[model samples]
Target: MAGPIVSRVSRVSGANGSSAAPIFVDVDTGVDDAMALAYLLASDDARIVGIASTAGNVPVDQVCANNLGLLALCGADVPVSRGSDRPLAAPLRTAEDTHGPEGLGYARLPSRDGTLTDYDAATAWVKAARDHPGELIGLVTGPLTNLALAMRIEPALPRLLRRLVVMGGAFDYRGNTTPVAEWNISVDPESGSEVFTVWSAAWGLDRPTHLPIVLGLNLTENIAMTPTILSRLAAAAGSATTPMSVLDDRGSRSAASNPLIRVLEDAMRFYFEFHFDQGEGYLAHLHDPLAAAVALDPDLVRYEQATIDVELTGTLTRGMTVADWRGHWGRQPNAHIGVGVDPEVFFDRFIARVGPYAATLG
Candidate 1:
């Protein structure tokens, strides 16, 4: 069942009508992360100012390589930077089983001469915020480590950006990583806690009308990608590929003519298999891409304001996200928790934006 598609400025302009929405991307380069980055690169309304590679789906080193390589593949000249290889307080753990080795599933990127910035991810994040103060839109589809670190050095970080969108947590929903915790937050609960804490504090100080919008598992799991959707995307890109099917072999690869479509098909095949093996279905939840979309267009999803907190002490619920509604906690609402979205509308946007972009590439 689909949800309502709220209407808002899908593409925002500068106050002086001079520039597109300046966005800063922080990602773990998961398969979905790749999809999200591609979506942003394709959006003419989105101006990607910088990218911060974080450690989640894979190590930060591989994340940076993936970011740089993806930018090169798309022929987009975007600056990529590296963040912490490990979590702020926990030992680093990766999701190679879910996203495959190197984070992009079975898809291989072409050799690229693109390089990372000399500064670290934390510095990159702070610098981007400082450079585009009160205008930068921060999108994090990975762990909160880099953002939390940046917030520490620059306390005004929460206010520095016009808006922030996060793709993590599970507001009383089934967790992808554990029985009660989401993968990104479970990877670094302390950092997740830090982000909410600092964001709430700064937001309280400034009292900005827009709160941080967070898309958690409760909502994201509904936006799933199936084989049929992939076929439509290929058709839109004018690529002929071996159609994906449940009857296909477990490790089948894509044969799309277009390079971008081929890579996405290959990557999504693994993701589909991962979910199917986990008893979900022959579909993959497009968590990150939805976050990327919501980052540019908040109207894609209906959000409810709430005070959200991360648990760090429970042995079994250390990374669990707890949302307080009805003023139970006596604190102001700190985040806008996404509660509804029309997957069809989102898929339509994805196909229309990415398919043509893919068609333009080799």
Candidate 2:
């Protein structure tokens, strides 16, 4: 259901400065995505105006369900809409085993049949940009399918958006889904290509200012989900399990002891168990949240300008993010590439931001 539009900037800028922009999030609800949503809701620097779900960590249907469930858990009022069923080019591939059957680490959600905006997801995205013209920040935490659709439907998308921040591709690190291509781009390289070509050409903004796709594996993998963070998450799991409890359990309980811990315990234990079985132990990569973090704070990452294009035809290299970082091709760089992150400080800030949200998960 829609919540009162209490001035997007005021709601997000709570205690931080009052210059935060309104955010439009497109997601595929994995556990990390759930955490990101909670973090954004908690932050004073972001106002999540809307959410569009796509096919990625799980099927489109399940992702939508997860999105609504997570928003409801936060007691948020943002609109949730269904997006593209498949990528703009290739067939859709979902990470069922990784996200579990429900795409939320099998976190049980309530029967919250909330109403969404009447507009289609693509139309809603363009409208959000148009209504606020150059004031909206597009935060894409999943594949670029819905965004490609928006560009196709609204030919003036370049003029509508202030900035488009995406989570995909790879420059130096090994890919999570393949050796060369990251999971989001590999799912639909054509969409990634379309976004890069259209936004870069249509905006006429400075070379590195038009469209920025935050490469996942390269910048985020190092921001591991450490045990200390998991323990903090475990302590905060009560927020995800209140529907099962009566009023006796409502408000002002000792946070150190949470009922939601049972679910977090199961999810994290399962997550670590699977990774450990593969010999990686408790360490799991930070794939999507770090991308959202870039949108929230660009300084967390060190960027280098580059010309980027996706390989759509190569049997072996298809879906790879072919970046021209050294200007060998003699063309203007289309986008900025994120090459490095302050590992210690990045994780430290991430832990500080997400620790409270993880506590809410229980």
Q: Largest TM-score belongs to which candidate? A: 1
Cα lDDT of model 1 by residue, 1-362, tens digit: 12222323234456557557889999999999999999999998889999999999999999988888888788999889999999998899999999999788888988767988999999999999999887899999999999999998899898788889999999979888889999999999999999998898887845545578889999999999999999999999989898899899877788899999988988999999899999999999999999999988888998777788999999888899998866777777778889889999999999999999999995
Task: Pull out the clashing pairs in model 1.
Answer: none
User: How does residue 267 of candidate 2 score in lDDT?
Assistant: 43
- TM accuracy, model 2: 0.83
lDDT of every model, 2 decimals: 0.89, 0.68
Error of 1 at 318 (Å): 0.7
Best by lDDT: 1
Model 1: residue 232 alpha-carbon error in angstroms = 0.7
56-129 in candidate 2: lDDT tens per residue? Answer: 88888788888776666556788988887888867889886666678765356665567666776787788778
Per-prediction TM-score to the true structure, in the order listed: 0.95, 0.83
